[model samples]
Target chain A: MAMVLYELCGIDEELRFSPYCWRVRYALAHKGLTAETRPWYFTDKEALAFSGSDKVPVLVDGDQAIADSYEILRYLDRSYPEAPLLGDGMAESRARFFKHYAERSLAPAMLRTIIMDLLNAIHPKDRDYFRETREKRFGRALEEFHSPAKGLAQLDAALEPLRGQLKESDFIDGAAPAAADYLVFGSFMWARVVSSADLVSNADPVYGWLERMLDLHDGLGRSAMRVTDVEGAYR
Target chain B: MAMVLYELCGIDEELRFSPYCWRVRYALAHKGLTAETRPWYFTDKEALAFSGSDKVPVLVDGDQAIADSYEILRYLDRSYPEAPLLGDGMAESRARFFKHYAERSLAPAMLRTIIMDLLNAIHPKDRDYFRETREKRFGRALEEFHSPAKGLAQLDAALEPLRGQLKESDFIDGAAPAAADYLVFGSFMWARVVSSADLVSNADPVYGWLERMLDLHDGLGRSAMRVTDVEGAYR
Candidate 1:
């Protein structure tokens, strides 16, 4: 059976920066499975149309096509029960809380800081579509929303809960990386691959957690094609 | 074995409003256990001296005493082992995340909205102590921090994650109210007992969750003595 993951890539298709896609990638690695990466651009809606969702992170396993990253993770867990991602004892609800927290608070704060870098990293054909759609959603120009200083402040405050948790445990899901850890880790992966922005200070425990996360699953995140690593802080 | 719970109560001893204390009370009910409620006032610090902490919700079970709501919930599961509040498997980490969320994000957002009412609801003798400590912590007077409008706006936005979760499930921890649900329910319980600020609109799913939470454990929350019922929107 062939497993394929439709991921949002950049002008250089090697640069995969979509946080949601990163989530599924981590989940796949966590479950000891492999998927053929199908690079997708923002304007390439036709590629994802078969999945009934106009977004990337569409995963096709055998005959089933899954749209959302979360749904794909769930589908994988249901399909592969070996190394459970959600953990034991109905921890699915807890993982869901982390998803909401990341989407509602962390991602917005991060987007504010790295939107410009993200714009530069996407496919050339996606620049217009990305700007137009994002601007429409925000009801303002990307320049107005892009404030690294203000965003960094908000991001730190938004991460207070995670930072507090990491102080007591190594990972969000504890002992080992699980669904809860992967959900929040997606936010940092977006920033890590696209921008050179110092998301967390070296003194902070979050910085340590980031280093540990990058080292997970045979350094999958660490081996990513980061823009900062290529061009030396071009953003 | 006799179990006695020392809880923080207001001037009217029936009026208990400490969110931390409420967390334990709900956990106790969830475990299908009862403890003799000992109403404690803020000025009554000497009463909690045996717990080695100057806090309410000190649960004395048999010969052991436990402080902190999270610790007490853990203790309940460890001692009782029946009707487990944290749930099975590695759900402990998930419950821990909720603790951090409630303490760091939810509680602060809610305190800004209900601090004034909280002050008024405490024992008259504790007023001066409360004002001094809180003022020092906030670096300002209570009057400056008592903006219900600004606080309400931040609170509604802060509750975005919980609202999203409640839309899909009856409780934070899924169909049944677990440790995660009790962790957050404490914040709303604080507002319910001390003030009638209309925390959530009936139109919101969070409002529905609150009503459901109030009715849980055989109307344990609904039966709580509230200041609003006594003096009709006086705040």
Candidate 2:
């Protein structure tokens, strides 16, 4: 049986915009493994029931089913050890820091900037569920909560640590892209695929790192489908 | 020819509070090495002139003089190669992420919280230099800019990433304290030695990690001299 990865997609299946799913997508590419991507929409809970997770980015390898982006990355690294997503035990722990940092800091900042854009990009069927859940989480309408100016400033501040680190090294993992790189790149992929707003300034070192990340894995991320021209939109 | 570290100190020679210097102190302990710490005051620029850098935490090992906390850690790991401060090249890179994260995010937040406290903690001779430089940096009187409530809130928000990661592991470097642990611990040590304000609540996982960090190296951090009682203040 071939390996399969369930990815969150829009009405256009090629519009795979979930940041968590993008993490797994990039992790697979990093590990030099190819898995058939199965498009799963936000409303498709039944499709993911076998994985015991309501979320997309579920990995089914042979008979084993794995869920959660972090868990899936760990599983891939542990199961395939050849081209490791995380380097070693010590490196893995450090990678977890960046993973958590991105999850807690960067993603939320990005979400606030592009919440409406994300809602529009998803499958029309998932619109009500997304809006209802997200509205409840923020305690306000999605449109009201998102301010591009405020979101962009918050994101720029959040990106400072990453910018500082990237200025000294080519990758977050240094010398090479790894799990930490993908963890952060996933957020940018979400922004690229869903939002037309310029999230990071071209002058920032983080912008340069993003270019390097997009160019990785045979231009896998570079070739990704975006809501607008990726070059013009991101720059 | 012995291992000697020049650490920043207050009027009370024993009251060493420079965050960068504390990083070296803990890092030396992590590597199972001992260095005789020399008290260096902020006004004592002539003392560090030989090292070609006007900085605290200048380490003199045999004939070699190294400056900068991050550089010193790398030097220690490379020179000793026993009980390494950084586990490997990969681990070192990952550690850099935390190092940079703490430096860029955590330290600035902490500095805001304790700037006035830090001024009060420095040597009487260094007071003028300290106030002049710091006030110039902020472009306002220290007292006007600082609000313990606002500072603590900013610090707590900045620490969210570290708090999230620490919930899963014993240390930032994972099972044991390493360069990254010392990198962040140094900032807390700055707050610990200078400020009476509770930067982290006892319920925070970060507070527990701080307890663990203090207990490392036979209570090296715990036994340090503070303007106020460290135990009563931190708790």
- lDDT of candidate 1 at residue B95, scale 0 to 100: 85
Where does candidate 1 stray beyond 4 Å? A229-234, B230-235
Q: Which candidate is the best by lDDT?
A: 1
Residue A142, candidate 1: C-alpha displacement in angstroms: 2.0
Each model's lDDT comes to 0.87, 0.85
DockQ value of candidate 1: 0.64
Which DockQ value does candidate 2 get?
Answer: 0.73
Instruction: Give per-residue lDDT, candidate 1, residue B220.
Output: 94
Question: TM-score, each model?
Answer: 0.95, 0.95
Candidate 1 accuracy as lDDT: 0.87
Tell me the deviation in Å of residue A81 in model 2.
Answer: 1.5
